[model samples]
Target: MLLKYKYKLKPHKSQSVIISNWLEIARKQYNYRLAERLNWFEATRTPVNACPLNVSVVPVEGIYQNIPEFR
Candidate 1:
């Protein structure tokens, strides 16, 4: 069997940490926004994602099953 791939990534320690932090922040922000949309819907009877500011989608099932933090 042969696997063929050609790619190079040379990230320094600081770069890696920055990327990790960004991902974590993004995930948390996404969840928080989703919660906000749900709250709006409950209070105002408007569906989440109905408005431009509330661009929320419930996480599709089984996506990102193995997040790094879980390890």
Candidate 2:
């Protein structure tokens, strides 16, 4: 047998707004990186319709054609 618990939060308006902004920033960041990686793959004929769940999503060739050393 197993048990699980769920919790709900009722943050204040200001806090909720802050949280929403942070989430939006994170989502945008993720999409930006995803696009960068997908576009970098030139050799693969397979299309990237969505983010791959496979561990081998990035080939041995690697993603990011011009990843900045500082970034």
Clash count per candidate: 0, 0
Question: Using alpha carbons, what is the TM-score of model 2?
Answer: 0.57
Off by over 4 Å in 1: 1-8, 46-71
Go through the candidates in order and give each one's C-alpha lDDT: 0.78, 0.78
After superposing candidate 2, which stretches have Cα over 4 Å from the reference?
43-71
Model 1, 1-71: lDDT tens per residue? Answer: 99999998788999999989999999999999999988976766555666654444545554666655543
Candidate 1 local Cα displacement, residue 30, angstroms? 0.9
Worst 10 residues of 1 by lDDT: 53-62
Which residue pairs in candidate 1 have backbone atoms (N, alpha carbon, C) closer than 3 angstroms, thus clashing? none
Model 2, span 1-71: residue lDDT tens: 89999999999999999999999999999999998877766534355686544547557656766676763
